[model samples]
Target: MKKTVRLILPVLAALTLAQAAQATTPSRVVQGTTELEGEVAKLGETFTLGKQSPLNFTLLKVEYSVGHVVIGNTVYSPKAAEKLLLLHFAVHNPQRRDVRYYWPDLKFTAVDAQDRNHPYAQAVARDGTTERLEINLKPAQKVNVLTVIRVPAGGGVPKLLVQREAALLRYDLRGQVQPLPKAVADPTDTSGATPLTQVPAALKTFNPLERFDVRLDDVKFTGEALNGKAPAAGQRYLSAVFTLRNMEPGGGRYAWSDFKPMLRDADGERVEYNGLLLKASRDETAGGTLGAGEEVRVRFFFALPANVNGQTLTLADGTGRAYVYDVSGVR
Candidate 1:
């Protein structure tokens, strides 16, 4: 048995490495005018901005801002010799299932007039103007992405090398810095309830939440204690499934801890998620950097006294911006 296991291990390792190699092969976008066969796109390249790629994605538009840039309700001011850039894009997922779109995971570099390379700023701009680290999307979801990168103060961003997966897309950034008009409010705001139309345009900057943008689409509660397991003595388990969308375009980092969750009773008494319940539903509480244009369905579980009623769930982003959902229907 030992000999057989040793023999199979090497073969399994070889197969895994082969699969990884094949998965990293570069794909081309059908819309780019000039496709460089390699990963680096030098200056003078004319890559199409909005064409859908063979990878099932696209880069819609690119914008830049200097000095103090205001996105939503936050302002981003660069340091002494640095400038901020806003790369706007639309990443579409044509698949039938949810896919992970990581914007910051993509590499961005700036090339100055003197042929120098400056890496993307390590720290992303604060607020919704930035991107999430990882974005999980539902089927056929098209997310509008806004990404901000910092470059040197003086040298112009004549060329930008964008590396996505194994492919390299080079865009000529010369003369592309357009002035931003006044930020406008979405007409739908007056409707009262947040829109979950799944349309990209519906994703607007939600105020009060400083670093991240999120709106609760819908909530579902299971009256039963547990779906696949039994409940504890005198305690009943209730689960709330929430559809959350990360609104940052530059794709940075967010976590489950960021959206502090709490439960309040009819009398205004507050309680948190049961640690044991969270342990059982580990996948439901998983947290990390949510990519721009990504949406995640998170399930939060609480164990309450069987007779307790009239409860509400309050979820807050890192900025203390919160939304309350009434759980009274489950009673």
Candidate 2:
């Protein structure tokens, strides 16, 4: 009986210690706000804005540093004695239809400890895409926004000031700012000239527009003039052929220009299309109304440095999505 009792006592004590350790372990942090309207809200709190078409906004987190900040593939640094502040937040539109809004539209300003006001420098998406001053949000859509601001390094806790037509909204950012972390190396970094994936030659259709389909057919590079149109000195012409089709029940307008095509090399160098060359080609399918089930072949021309190789053609819809086509064979 004594031996059994001793064994049971050790087991019970071990179980209790394990349970205590588990209870003391920290869990994930939940972000929320505890401030009311007309009062300065703190970080992790949700604030309501707008009157008729209301928007629920929450400041999730903030990062500040005097060093460089990386947005997408670009790096931004502040001047001496200045630090960059990044405010990350979410905005929701609860309307039934699409609503257009922007950070600047809110008339946001940052008030420093010295009572100096600083306007927003810029805003970008997580992928580093620059956010225009106006963006359309579908009903019930939520988007994460990042805004960059420059403030004095010694500036005491800054407050966010929002100007509305009826009342002003303020957010206290004390104890919410954290030091910016070192940027991790991106696997897709092209500093070493890593090549993009080669798109298969098989027909791969991309629907960049509503009720429209597009597919790359061929790509060619030439140093000579094309149909009496010659490229400038030390430059060559790259022509990409594509097939466009309309799938809408009713006729719809289709234009190659709508794709907003651009060429990016493996080294991140970009080149723009030659508008004159496109107009000079006079491809009947360049811009026209396509009936249902009708398709047309279109060609676009771009002038690039004679030495550029391993390039990719990027075509974007106005809605922020882009399609990439490998043009490494163009060399």
Candidate 3:
């Protein structure tokens, strides 16, 4: 009788252990809200809110801190018995038109181990500012977003809950907690004044406007002063002359707005346009109609950081066709 009882006890012990292990294992599939009846996703996975929405979300990483969290120059602390949870993710807009969104549009919640819910506390912007969370996304634009939530301390892995109108999504952040990364320096800083590569001068032409063929006549880097007036500190000016000819057999209207000119530095960062200088200068182009075979010379001005060297000029037509010109050698 004793031997029989021992065999049964061993079998019961093995069954209990198996059940405990299964309970702790993370499940990839989870239930969604009523709107998203069939959607399921795991952490580090990308998912869309719904078929009608053009927004896509991907949870990249998650971090938790029991101590104070530092963002920019401000430090945030959680209430007693709670910890600060940081969620790093990317929000992407794939549509052609611009999409504007505010934080309240997507309801966010953090579910702790005890099944208690916590709301989002704050959001950090690209500049590390914890102000209002609002963004305008251009076509094919993706922006990284950081959200902070306060969850009960000593809770196991928490799950992120997001709801957008009719769709709801959840991500189980289990075994994915990582140490907060050190703050990274801004990549767009050009204060080092690195010299740009010089490209040989050449004649470049672009048909950026309807029924118009434009030829680049010359590009000149006019230092600081325009019409005897200098720009504010840390700014310079550039001027480019283009010869535009009407290509249509009939007369056609032409305007500077027809061709949107953009200047970029060696790192592909945009150089701001100086409207004040253009308004004051006599070389600014004017809108007019041109007859067939008529050609006119137009000059455009751009403002750039004093430490930056302009590298390329991008011209876009009304139809969104773009043409690039090398201007690194203009001095």
Candidate 4:
């Protein structure tokens, strides 16, 4: 009788331990709110996952997916046509906080007909979509946000970032996400980053860039600079350009709207894209501006950590209408 009683006590202890281990994952029982924890586990005859501290309640989960970038055949003139590259993204934030955070300054860059890294406009997903969720937390929450990227999509462009996500802490930008592909020769490296290292680049999209026609020669690009880093991952500064010249001066300055831009590598994968985006200011060196029919080179400089995936200079633009151009080389 004594031996049987001792055996029962041991079994009961083991059962308690098993219950604790199973609590780490989301289960059918925890239907209202889900909690994710980063834990440490030691493997011996048996394994036990030890819990560490949890992150801010502001963040529950950030999950996303890329779809595709659709191209159109319509032509808008010169530097004012549509180079629509659809970046389909789905972001799922399952937290209970109305996250009020400053936005990171991000841009989508791509190479142009001249094989230069040009930047483009900031893109956004349609409102009221499952992918466009911006909410205040109520203890338990789950929301999905999508971003539609329609920037410059073309050839010779090494890479393009269809969509982007920004992260930060202590009032400083921490990380970012954009759409980019690996180069075949060095498909694992970002400028100098290791392929195995998960250095935050941009978000990878399922969709591809769609090509279109627009005027080239009659339009020129001057660089613009900004203070705040790109809203996307690991950005330092934002540089962009406005129209430099139109053969007839003001002949075709305001002929288009919805200007878009992108960046590509020598191998032609879009690294970044921006639509309706703007630069940041810091009092004295406030953001720069451009004027139509104006021909002067403008550029703002920024940097990325040497060990992380960095940003290179690039350019592109479109009006989302009909257009054409005759481009001259500038190198």
Each prediction's Cα lDDT score? 0.53, 0.62, 0.63, 0.29
Which tens-of-lDDT digit does each residue in 1-331 have in candidate 2?
9999999999999999999999999988999997435656777777677787677777787767543444433344454345567778777787888887675545567778788888866445542443233568898787877777777655344588765454467877765666432231113532211112222233356432334566777778866566456888988878877777665555677765566678876577888765422332453335778886688777777777777774688765443334577787666
**Residues 278-326 of candidate 4: C-alpha lDDT, one tens digit per residue:** 3222212322332423333223233332223322333333322211111
After superposition on all CA atoms, how large is the RMSD of candidate 1? 23.1
Report the Cα lDDT for residue 309, model 4: 30
Model 4 weakest lDDT span, ten residues long: 41-50
RMSD of 2: 20.1
- The runs of at least 3 residues in candidate 2 whose Cα sits more than 4 Å from the true structure, single-residue gaps closed, are 1-37, 67-76, 122-134, 180-331
Error of 3 at 324 (Å): 61
**Candidate 1 structure, TM-score to reference:** 0.35
lDDT of 3 at 290: 83
Q: What is the TM-score of each candidate against the true structure?
A: 0.35, 0.40, 0.40, 0.22
